[model samples]
Target chain A: MRPSDIAFRLYLVALFTFVFLPILTSMVFSLNSDRFPTVPLGEFTTHWYKTAFSRPEVWTAFGNSLIVAVCAAALSTALGFVTAYTDFRYGFRFKPAYLALALLPPTIPLVIMGLAMLAWLGRLGISGTLSGIVVAHTVMGAPFAMAICRLRLSQMDPALEAAAWNLGASQWRAMRAVVIPFCLPALISAYCLTAAVSFDEFIVAWFVSGLNKTVPVMILEILQGNVDPQINAIGTVVFLTSMALVIVAQLLILRKTNA
Target chain B: MTDTDPLVRFSGVRKTYGTFEAVKHLDLDIGRGEFVAIMGPSGCGKTTTLRMLAGLEEPTAGEITIDGKRMNEVSAHDRDTPLVWQSLALFPFLNVKENVEFGLKMRGVSKPDRHGRAMLWLERLGLKGFETRRIDQLSGGQRQRVALARSLVTEPRMLLLDEPLSALDAHLVIRMQGVLTRLQKELGITFVYVTHSQSEAFAMADRVVIMGHGEIAQIGKPQEIFRAPKNRFVAEFVGRNNILPGKTPGQEIVVAADRMQVSASDPGEGALPAEFLSEEFAGTGIICYFEGPEGVELKAQVTEDQLENLAPEPGQRFWLTWAPGAAHVMAGT
Candidate 1:
């Protein structure tokens, strides 16, 4: 091609390389056999992965994070379903205020939310437990779920519900048969995103988790003292799982919008 | 009207949204096995009244009785009134058979029975081979028929349709009208329909109920409502009709508008001369517009054969006349 076009192509290639090199380097280091992670010449081994797998503390943290993610996702999705349906279908006097209230938690800073949750739960003598972490994650995640589900609800035909009602179906049945099916993709996406957000979350979980270490918190602890092979292996696992969840969520979002 | 008791009765039924009354206090009786079309302008409470009858909305006042049962407290599902929506509202996720079976399934019908009934209706609606097809896969008319099959599968006593043909193409609309009329006849069920198009109301309804400002303006057979409109609103709304203001000298009143002065032998009291404005050809008839002395533009339809004798022109003034019994005068607003 032309000189300028070649130069522009080179620039794009450099930008792509800059963005992807670090991730590639990390993946390479994660498999390195040396005590200190290094470039290009280290022997590859599966020992770190095995060590990471066998570590009870790491597994416990992973399990804790999984549980917190699942419960938070389920709670957020349920609340979002209700919020979207209520806002779309009914005319309540406080709709604006209610919407603002639902959105408040997400707009607030995570640090502030974490601190507030710590204080509130401590006041009730319930701070730093798994349940407290779940509550915090659910509160933080619900707004995102609500936004996604609301968009889905807005795109759907209101006549679907009305049709069901006219066909001798109750409001509940209409929701179940018509409305819910239309919103399913959004609901699934919201759940996945909520789960992924809770899984990767550090600040909020750190404050509300007390002695119960989530995967992020455990990774942070492991990285602080030394650069262990086990840490790299655990990081790789977390990165893979998060990527999978995010990809699934994005696909669901695409389907929902297109449909 | 038939001698059989009315299947659905509305006595002073009204519904209001906040301060906006959608359906004013109104009375109507739909006889058993009758196809009744509720017709009106937009915001005239036709759909609102249908919703109230379907138990989707509760009346602010008055009573609705269906099959000798007070329906105010009954839920939508138990009302057994199926409504065919203008959008069809077929469940996109469900295939044709499943969509048709949805209502019966919700009512806890056994699986085999639901499928059997759904298949029966689907076959009856000429959709037997397409039962496995998704809603999006069907053509517009086909989707409409699927919606009908779904509603009819439940064998409801009354069917309420809210402008079901408004979304279809003109050709499809006419075809669907025939299908709907035949279905209603064969099922022998009460059909309460709401529409804003006068042609649809005229073509399909055994009786037409015209609404305005959330109240019933006139209720009668298609021919009756079209031939003898009770007031200026119904006259203008039912079809093209020429109206002019005229007063009776003794028993005879002269209505002059659009170069036509017609005299009514029994013109009602307070009739006066109305100004004639314009005229337009409408295929089978010609519509002449006039502004009555009351400042109301009135429309009148003259058939093709009648156009020859009158020989209407823009400003050529002629006497406007109608039989005394032909004019229906309303009370002063």
Candidate 2:
């Protein structure tokens, strides 16, 4: 191989190693029968996995995270699709402003967004509840869903929906028959992405999820209490879950539409 | 409605987007079972007129009636005017058969009935075996036929076609034109076709409507529009005609290109002097352009034998005279 090609391949290898090494280290530690993670070889065992899952609080946290992710993904995807359809189908005054406001939440710093949600949901009396965490995640995730859906909608022929209407489909029927079917891939991708986002989120859930701890929140709590091997086991599970969701989302969005 | 009652009519119809008028004072009557083509340049409001008739666009100030029923506020889906778009706009996600059955599905027709009708149209358009194929798998012409079948499956009383053949190859365009004309004749439905192509409009249309600046320049049989254009715009837009100014003020005359004779020598009385500029090869004749008096351009279509006899060169002086009784005086300035 040419020297430049070899160098580029090495760079890519280094980049992936840098990204995955920490997760790989945690996975290795999750199986090691040791109190602390170290370079010296330790006997591999499932002791930490058993220990972490045995706790009722840990199980509750995992359940809460799943619930938040599903609810947040559904709510955000609905919001995103409506926002995208509005942008696609209408040409009203201040359209740019409408889009900016719709997509503005993600541009804010996560800490600030967390703080704002804590305060807003507090006034609504839903803070510290699982519903509050779901709402906060939905706000953060809607913009992503909106971006994906908007990209798909932009690629559509502007006349497709109108053609449906011309062929005896009313406005709602046209949406069901044409626009929704065309955006289905984007919708599913957005759902997976928002679900991953909500599942992995820690800061906003920490702010608003008062009593019901999500997985990330529980992991932090466990870390604050002590640096234990069980944290490594939980961390590996969290990482795998997020990665699975993200990979599915990526494949859905990148696939060539045979339509 | 009776065949002579006119299938569609527009009276004092005007459509304006803010300060820009897309269609101004359109008064047209499309007869039943007629093939009418609206020809114009881009942004000449031909599309807007079709959209209005299809209930996609509301007229600013007038009445549009389909079969004597006022249809100003009828929504698009409620109207039976199915339109074939310029882009075809077939649903990419749906297979060929599903796309054709869309209108029937929307109308809540039974599944088997929709399938039978869709198949009938697909077969009629010569797309029988490819029913289950994805839209992307089909060729451009096949997709075009799919779009036609999709619109025609509804068996509406009228069809609105917006530049449907403009995307086809020249040879394919000729083939599709024959297909479209044959289908229109067999269906005996009113076909409102909008096109910017002079030949497409002239070749297939029983009546050609020339639109310019959102107004009807002239509406007549293609041959009549070719033989006698009503005004300067009509004459110029229709093309291949020499529009000349009469000696009297505010008078203009239109002479067909074939009727104009180009002679090397002065032909005595009523001979107009012209200088040959260039010639374009038209299959049957050579269309010669000349710089005439008052700086107006004149066109004359001459046969190969006539061209060889004169042996005309660019910038060669010639006398222009028309056949007796061929000059038509245009109405209005």
Best-performing candidate as measured by lDDT: 2
Chain A TM-score for each of the predictions: 0.90, 0.97
Which candidate gets the maximum TM-score versus the true structure? Answer: 2
Question: Candidate 2, which segments miss by more than 4 Å at Cα?
Answer: A1-4
Classified by CAPRI criteria, candidate 2 counts as medium
Report the Cα lDDT for residue B298, model 2. Answer: 93
Q: In candidate 2, residue B107 scores what lDDT?
A: 94
For B51-122, candidate 1 gives per-residue lDDT tens digits of 899888999999999876799988787778888887777888889899999889878899999989998998
User: Mind giving the per-residue lDDT tens digits that candidate 1 earns over A1-259?
Assistant: 9999999999999998999777666677778888787655478888889888888998899999999999999999899789877899889899999999998887788899899999998988878788899889999889889998998888887877877777667777787878888899989999999999999999988888989999999988888988787877787788788879889988988773423
The interface root-mean-square deviations, each candidate in sequence, come to 2.0, 1.3
User: How well is each residue in B1-333 modelled by candidate 2, as lDDT tens digits?
Assistant: 676899899999999999999998899999999999999999999999999998889999999999999999999999999999999999999999999999999999999999999999999999999999999999889999999999999899899999999889899999999999999999999999999999999999999999999999899999899988999888888889988887688898999999999899998999889999999998769999999988899999999999999898999999999976899888874
Candidates in order have lDDT scores of 0.81, 0.94
The 10-residue segment with the lowest total lDDT in model 2 chain B = B324-333
Going through the candidates in order, the fraction of native interface contacts each one reproduces equals 0.79, 0.91
Q: Give lDDT for model 1.
A: 0.81
For residues A1-259, could you state the per-residue lDDT of candidate 2 as single tens digits? Answer: 9999999999999999999998999999999998888879589899999999999999999999999999999999999999999999899999999999999997898899889999999999999999999999999999999999999998899889999999999999999999999999999999999999999999888988999999999999999999999999999999999899999989989999754
